[model samples]
Target: MKQICVFILVLALTSCEYFNAKKTTPEAILNEELQTFNWNDVDVYPTFSECDSIETKNGKTTCFTEVLTTHILEKLQKDSIVVTQDVTDTINLKFQVSETGILSLLNIDTDSLIMKEIPNIEALIYSSLDSLPKVFPAIKRGQQVKTEFELPVIIQAN
Candidate 1:
C-alpha cells in the first residue's frame, strides 16, 4: 500500500508539472506583439487643407503633391536664386508630418552645384513649407499617425 501511494503521488506531481509548463516566454510575447503592429503602410495618406474636400485616396494624394510642389517652386522663383550654369538634377527631400499637422524636415539630397549656387536652399524650402496650410496627418488603424515622405524636385537650369 505504501509503494502504491508513493507511485500515485509521483504521477500527480508529474501531471501537474506538465500542465503548468510555461507556454509563452517574454521574447515570444514580444515577437507576437511586433507581428501584430503594422509597419509597412498607413490606413490613410496625409493631406493638405486644399485636399480635404477630395474623397478618393488617389485624388487626395495627387492634390497634396501638386500643392506642395507648386508652393516650393513659387517660393524658389520669388527668391531669385540664379543658377550660373546649365544643369539638370533632382533634389530629394525627406520630411515628416506629425499627427498634429506640423512639418519637420528630415534630409535633403541635391547636387553639390545646386547647393553651392543656392547656399540658402534649405532655408528657402523650410520657409516655403512653413507657409503651407496645416496638413491632416496619416491614419493608421483608426488613429492619426506621423508619416514620412520623400519628394524628388527636378531642377532644370536653362
Candidate 2:
C-alpha cells in the first residue's frame, strides 16, 4: 500500500538524520590521541613475580606499599559487605608479580562474602591497583628473590 511505502521512507530518513546529528566532541578526539603516555604503557615490572628485583629492606619498605594497601582496603570496603561487617576471619589473595611490575591476583581465599560477591572482589582488586606506582627492580640469578608477598587485610564493620 502507499501508506506502508511512505512509512518506510520516513523511517529511513529519520534514521539517517539521527545518525548524522551525532558528533564526537573535541575532548573525545583528544582522549583518542594514541601517543598520550600512560604508566601502563611503560611499566617496568609487568607482573608480581617480576617484582623480585624490588629490594625489600628489613625495616624500610617502599613508600607505595602502605598507600597501595590502604587504597585496596578502601576499594574492598566500599564494594564488599563482608569487609564492612568487621568479620574476624581473613581472606588471603595470592598473586604473582611479573617482571613488568604488575601484581596478578591469582586466587582469593573464599570467605562467606567473597563467595557471594565474586564480581565485587574482581572489581575492587583492579580498581585499587590502577593507582599504584610501578617500580619493581629485576632480580639477580645468584641472589634469593622474593617477588610474592601476602597482605592480610582486616575487615571491620564501623
lDDT of 1 at 96: 90
What Cα-based lDDT does every candidate model obtain?
A: 0.84, 0.55
Whole-structure CA lDDT of model 1: 0.84
Model 2 TM-score?
Answer: 0.46
Off by over 4 Å in 2: 1-56, 61-65, 77-86, 117-119, 141-146
**Candidate 1 per-residue C-alpha lDDT over 2-78 given as tens digits, one digit per residue, 9 for 90 to 100:** 99999999999889867775678999999999899879688778988788888988888789888888888887778
Judge candidate 2 at residue 130 and give its lDDT. 75
Residue pairs in collision within model 1: none
Candidate 2 residues 1-158, lDDT tens each?
99999999999988887677668999888778645634232222222333345655421244335545676787766663543333454667675665545666676675776445453665667677776656454343333233555556555443
